[model samples]
Target: MTLNVLFAARPERWESYEPILKSEFARQGLDVALSTDHPPETVDYIIYAPNGPVQDFTAYTRCKAVMNLWAGVEQIVGNETLTQPLTRMVEEGLTGGMAEWVTGHTLRYHLEMDLDLARKPGDWSQHNPPLARDRPVTILGLGQLGQAAGQMLAGIGFPVTGWSRTQKDIEGITCLSGDEGLIEALKTAQVLVLLLPDTPATTNIINPESLALLPKGAVILNPGRGPLIDDDALLAALDLGQVAHATLDVFRTEPLPEDHPYWHHPKVTVTPHIAAETRPATAARVVAENIRRGEAGEPFLYLVDRDQGY
Candidate 1:
């Protein structure tokens, strides 16, 4: 039997992924009908991106699942018409890229090497930096990216503490969870890193209370979702000298407006969402594998749970 699949993202991606996607499906020896659009009556599976133009899924009676191309599903989970199973992308390339970015930035802050590069000519100043052991790093949201980052930081002799919504015991990590645990974990950390997904429980999670738990002049790094931190609270913390500086990657708004305060803040570093991205080659392989499974009567991988909202 042939499974009819419709891809909802743009043709630009199809043009880029057609070769490898088709080749991989061929290797699996599955009979499938693959196209950007045929007819909703024939669509058995949908390769989706939240930003895609498939708002109405009431016509998709045959679709078994909605496979997302990206890791985040916040944009589409609440659609009442989307009754089929939804799955988020969880591929090798994304995880690896996230790990590398987190490690690179952590090391940069740990060594305080940026100060020397920012110095003017002949304005050399002798400064002795503290050892890695002296830097207590706290990682918020001990999920995939956070766990990987925490482990890497710990390997370099920095004391790593990780916090999540639920308790976990990771080797080489001082793991904590729950509301009370979050405060205690923050108190011990000199550098705080945010890597939580955007959800109701996570939105504006980094408020004044949590910021106050950290030691004075603490540094913050956020490469995760922008909504994870309370913007007003973070700004206030920076003003009071509780937070020395903040390095933010993702933001609530993309292509952040020129008039935004974050753009002109002297203590904040805004990177235009370049932390990590899913490579086309690897991501295409992951999509193909799921399509192969759907044909072979096997369960899909990285299926998203709408209840969890991730």
Candidate 2:
């Protein structure tokens, strides 16, 4: 049977994803009628992006699942019309990219790289950095991306601790959860990385009260959601020498307003939401695999939990 797959992202994305999706479907040996203009009622599946034109899923009566093209589903997870099974992208490329970014930043903090880079041209200021084992690194999320980064950091000798809303048991990393675990995790976080998703519970999670738990002069790296850290709280922390520096990528507002304090903060590094992006080549294969699973009566991978909102 041929499946009618609707590509529901922006018009420009159709051009980029069409051939890739087609190639993947052919490789999977599936007959798929993939297009941007398929009749809504006939669409057996939808390749979706939150920025897409398809807001009302009510029209797609036959759509068995909504396969998100991006890793984040926060933008579309609450759509009342979207009652179908929703799956977020979980591809190797994204995981690998996140691991690299986290590891690079973690090492930068561990080595105090900025101190050496900012030294005076003629002044020979001698500074010594500690080994990875001496530095306690904490990750806020223990999901796929977080676990991958944690494993990489642990492999390199960093004492890695992972925290989540619920308990996890990943080998080679200390995993913590719940309120008490949060405090314990923060107390030893000489370097902290935020990889949690954007949700009500996660917004402003790094507030003043939570920030106070970290060891003095703790370094923060946020490749996760922008609201994960409270801007004013982080600024205050930096000013008081509570936090040494912060590297923020995602933000509440895109293009990070010109007047945003994070842009001007001396100790803060603002990266323009470029920590990681979905690559069409690898992402296409993941989408194809999920579609194949749906057809074969197997469980979908990375299905989002509506109640948890991740």
Candidate 3:
């Protein structure tokens, strides 16, 4: 039987993903009618993006699942019209990309590479940096991306601590959860990394109270959701020397306005959200595997919990 799968993202995305998805479906021995224009009632699955054309899922009566093209589900998880099971992207490429980016920035701060890079013609200021073992790094969110980054950081000899809404038992990393755990995690975070999902509970999670918990002059790296940090509070912390520097890859606004203070802040490095991306090649394989699983009556991978809003 041919499964009708709807490619519900932008036209450009369809242009890139069409051939890859077709190859993956064929490799899995699945006959899939994959197209951008599948009738809603006939769509067996949807490869979706939050900004995709299909906003209302009410017409998709036969869709077994909606496979998100991105890791984040905050935008579509709350759609009341959609009752189908939703799965977020958790492909190897995306996870590895995040781990690499997080590890690179963590090392930069740990070694104070920026200071060396800014040396003058004759400025030979002797500065010794501590080893990774001496630096305690804390990562918010222990999901796949978080765990991958935490493990990489731990492998490099940094003491890694990971926090989440629930307890996790990953080897080589100290895992913490809940209110008390968050306090402890913050207290020891010499280099803090935010990889948490965008949820109501996580909005402004790095506000004044939380910022104060970190050791003074601590550094921050945010590659997660934009709204995770309170912009005003972070600016205050940076000015007060509570946070020495912040390398932000995500923000509340994309193409962050030219007038934004972060653009000119001495303590802030603004990166244009290039931390991690869902590579089409690996991501297509993941989407195919999930569709295959759905057809075979197997549980889908990376299923989002609606109540938790991840």
Give the top-scoring candidate (TM-score): 3
Residue 245, candidate 3: alpha-carbon lDDT: 98
What is the TM-score (0 to 1) of candidate 2?
0.97
lDDT of 2 by residue, 169-265 (tens): 9998999999999999999999999999999999999999999999999999999898898889999999999999999989899999999998899
Error of 1 at 258 (Å): 1.2
Which candidate's lDDT is highest?
3
Q: After superposition, which runs of candidate 1 have C-alpha atoms over 4 Å from their true positions?
A: none
lDDT of 3 by residue, 1-310 (tens): 9999999998888888999999999999999999899889899999999988999999999999999999999889999998999999999999999999999999898888998999889998888899899999999999999999999999999999999999999998999999999999999999999999999899999999999999999999999999999999999999999999999999998989999999999999999998999999999999999999999999999999999997
Worst 10 residues of 2 by lDDT: 118-127
What range of 10 consecutive residues in model 3 has the weakest lDDT sum? 8-17
Q: Which ranges of candidate 2 are over 4 A from the true structure?
A: none
Per-structure clash totals for the candidates:
0, 0, 0
* Runs of candidate 3 exceeding 4 Å displacement: none
The 10-residue segment with the lowest total lDDT in model 1? 16-25
